[model samples]
Target: NVEATKTVVDLISEQMEKGFEIPSDKVITVESSGSSDNVAIINCCFGHRVNETMGRVVALLLSARKGRNIGIEIDPYRIKLTPASSKEVLEVIKSLRPEAVPELAERALLDTKLLQWKIIHSARKFGYLSKDLDLSRINLRKLVIKLKDTPIYREAVREIFVEKMDVEKASELISQFGKSIKIKVYDSLSPIGLASREHAFDLLMPGKPVEALLRIFRQRLEKEVTVFHCLNCKYTVKTPIRLIGDLRCPRCHSGLIACFNARRKLEEIPKKELHRIANLVLSHGKKAVLAMNTHGVGAENAARILSKYYENDDKFYLELMEAERRYIRTRGFWD
Candidate 1:
């Protein structure tokens, strides 16, 4: 197992050294004399670290050259290229400035979710951050900025490097590229590479389609509870939109009801404002209830949306969808 690990690591190192290029449409595979299952395990374990290390190295270098962030997937046995060709990647590798690695590595970690989680977890362990802190309430980028030069941040980076990556070995192999190691491309994956493919992890890229976003928005609306306040009697009731049917207030028998998110406290709101909301609901009817029930849309915004004329229900819904999308995109900033 030890030898297999070293062999897989070395194979990955060679591939990274060559800038991860194979013949067009051809796959590179590792050959082994050992049991295929053992080879697979070795590839999964060590190959991942090697590929990840090299992937970071290349990604950082490319990002520097291009003046923008570049993303890449580090498969168990390969470093998937972003917008760069094999030749360009090889040039970047060849021109690697060893002195810049520490800074580059740190920069590479900035956008990684793993590093962020590790930083938070380590901070909690060291009592720098509260153990029960609500992760959703904090801005991760700001947190990282605050902890950048602190011991907690350094410890997190160290743990990631020591426990999960073979950056030093990868660097050494890259340094020895021409002298002791060389690239060998293959037409297809070998038996061991095929075995490695059996347990490969899935890569999930970001961004959702408009339809998917709308579907999610619809689901959220269905589950959302709205507080209905009767202006006449000051009686309030909370009901989920999915279960809400009757529009009339049971206590006052009035259709003049103000709608708010269930989280809103009636006591905190001034009576005059509550009356205004009630008037809004009375004027717009069910449309005002729906607008208020929409995530992140307050009474004023709902009023603006309800006041606008739409050609049809579809156009009105599309406007609501845009409002929801805007709210989603900016909610973190709001927090």
Candidate 2:
């Protein structure tokens, strides 16, 4: 399998160099017998770094075309672009300036965790740091500064270049555009392309939410439990929104039910705060309680959302969904 992968890479390289013509009925196919050798040919012939290289390329193309994020998968044989044809990729590549690639490729890795890990690993591998050193105690910024422009730093970049990416070949390919190579857009995927589309390690680009995802989101909200406290009787109970009925205290028959997150403890909530929450529930009723139960929607946000004039329950739920999405996206920044 290893030898076969090497041969494929060699053949591809030779074809690229010699300008081999393809027959109308024939398509060049690359295959590997084992998992370990699956991308060996691709790494050798194309840019070595599949994920990083393809990610950068796809991101650049998407920006140029003002396109939405789409899934991109690349293997030894072909690049699988979901909702995008091969022709689109070629056109984008053609537009890129060869002189700009090295800078762009390096910039793509600047904020990535991969680059950080590689720098530290290369430092250790080059004997710049003791093998016994504890990584947790070391400050990453200080370490990066200490190792910058050294042989260890160079080694890390070189590893990314040789093992992961071939910036040189990529630039060369860009320069040779329209000279030895031509773009051929296909209306449908070839058999080899179909085979390559089966496996996707990760989503190179994130896509927008669809109806199915929104349904799952709603299901999660419905299943989540809300802590309800009775203002008149001091009775507290946890109830899932799906099982909630009447919004009244079971023991006291009171409508003054305050909702809190299920994770909150009754003993921890101050009496004055509980009364304020009960007032909010008294004013807004069951709808506000459901909003409070939603993931990442606290009492203040729930109250603010309820203050808005929504035409129906659907509109209210849509606003809550948007709020939850915003919280989910920005939670990492808060941490």
Each model's lDDT: 0.62, 0.58
lDDT of candidate 2 over 1-335, digit per residue (tens):
45546544654455455443331112322222323212211111242244346446654564447456434444333443444444455556567787888777765555344566678778767777765565656665567667767888777767777876768766766566466544344434333333334322112212324455557667888888888888889888888878887788899899888887787666544456566677778898877777777767766677789889999767777788788765543331111
Work out the TM-score per prediction.
0.44, 0.39
TM-score of 2: 0.39
Identify the candidate with maximal lDDT.
1
Write model 1 residue lDDT over 1-335, tens digit each, in one string.
45556655665566556554321112332232332122111122236566667667777887788676554545445554445544455566677664556566666778676688778877877888775455656787888889988999999899888875777766655665445454343333444444333322111212345566556667777678989788778787888877777778898788878887787666544456567677788898767777877766776788899999999765776678777655543332112
Model 1, position 81, has a per-residue lDDT of 44
Best TM-score among the predictions, by candidate number = 1
lDDT of 2 at 117: 61
In model 2, state the lDDT of residue 72. 41
Kindly state the number of residue pairs that clash in model 2.
Answer: 3
Model 1 ranges with Cα > 4 A deviation: 1-46, 97-100, 183-335
